[model samples]
Target: MIRTHQGINTDDDLKPDLTPLLDIIFIVMVFLLLTASVKLQSLDVDLPQTDTRTLQTTQADPITINLMSQSPYWALQGAAVEDWETFKTKLVEAVKAEPEKPVVIGADKTGSVENMLKLLAFLQQNNIKATQLLMEEEK
Candidate 1:
């Protein structure tokens, strides 16, 4: 047992002070409430507004670019492309024929990743953003 400066041992001296703890908790709660209230009050938020009426759907058919194992070059539909230059020309022609048409790449499993990447990079260079990968449907 420890004695106070007066040289008397008492249970009152050993009692935990809860007033400061409660005060801190109350202060924190008030601060949180104030912050929450401020957040709840809506300010002038300039959120990006999208116009659904302006959204147009493309009526053109999707262009399919198939990477065959027979040759490293891509085939536009069933038409054979001799080189990258020829493929790009054909792709541009197709895109011109039907603007805003999406391109679907049918990459062969046997084809190298490097070739596929080259094709993708070429497409990106051509500013073709809408592209879909063709996959065999599971039965």
Candidate 2:
């Protein structure tokens, strides 16, 4: 028969033990630290890097090509291009005229990305490697 201890308080056994819980938590932490994986994702970008000394040597103005959100969406040197054919013709002439000048793509914030991609592909096809971009500063 089990001996009954009436004088002793039985509440001590009712209180939850924390040692096992803490040990499990530490085991989970160690497992996560060992099994976690880290990977870095990045893309190669072509960004213009200019120096003040180099700027002083070349005074040539950059050829600005604007991509608008409207019907006449393309602009070469601040003039709106009528159509794709005209844009190609004018761009070819401009590139040929000033081979040393950097081509700056100035796209409107509301403009479609398709136009920008087309412009980039055209530049690639024409082998215009020296290119820059213009973006409004975030206020």
Candidate 3:
């Protein structure tokens, strides 16, 4: 024999109230939906359309930076840079000349992540926001 509250015996057990649990779950879901819709302000670039057949270039003459596989070596606008000082000097000059020009960074798979991040940080610090990362096509 099973005894319930108030000394009543029946073939039933007390079931938990799920209404409060469901209410908490609903509130959490709504909070997540609101936060997920917000867009972050950072380097924003138009990605290439995979399904489009036409080639589209946004800028007339984009400034390209090629980070070599080796460290302490890079090429800005086709000319080679041996050190960070030279690279920064050239970059500052370029940015001063064309403030609105878009920058395309071509980093090899073997390049150092630290160096790449440093370059990106420099760009962000100097207010050069429009930047693109060039990726190699996989075979």
Candidate 4:
């Protein structure tokens, strides 16, 4: 008479082969290295640092052009122009007199984009340069 016990092979069932996982990880590593090297080769020059002490000054206060939802406005030395015709006239005169003077545009967030485009076109037509967009700080 012999005593015999038959049981399931738990170790063989629980152990998973890691060769496929290692192969996938190696493929991913190789792909990333190739892409990173290619990207590094494309960069051209070093970026410049901001200078905090530089103070910007114009001969006079910058002429500000304001664009509202309904109409366009222009201001100079804290005085608003009467109408668009006057604004254009003043802009042409200023550009002709001193083209180096900077022009700042103050536009409301809800203003019409058409007005801004028109104003930009007018400036370009007159060869006016050195224009900047002005934005109010969030409170």
Candidate 2: how large is its RMSD? 17.9
Question: What ranges in model 3 sit over 4 Å off?
Answer: 1-58
Poorly placed runs, candidate 1 (over 4 Å): 1-60, 137-139
TM-scores for all candidates: the values are 0.52, 0.56, 0.56, 0.48
Residue-level lDDT tens digits of model 4 in 18-85: 99999999999998766443111111112223344443333244555566554334454345566888
Native-referenced Cα lDDT, model 2: 0.69
Model 4 TM-score, all chains together? 0.48
Instruction: Give the number of the best model, judged by lDDT.
Output: 2
Clashing pairs in 2: none
Ten-residue segment with the worst summed lDDT in candidate 3? 38-47
- State the lDDT of candidate 1 residue by residue for 39-72, as single tens digits: 1111121222333344332223567677766564
How big is the positional error of residue 97 in model 1, measured in Å on the Cα after superposition?
2.3
What lDDT would each prediction earn against the true structure? 0.65, 0.69, 0.69, 0.58
How far is 115's C-alpha from truth in model 3 (Å)? 0.6
The digit string of per-residue lDDT tens for model 3 on 101-138 reads 77777676666778889988988888876556654333
Candidates ranked by lDDT = 2, 3, 1, 4
> Which candidate, 1 or 4, would have the higher lDDT against the true structure?
1
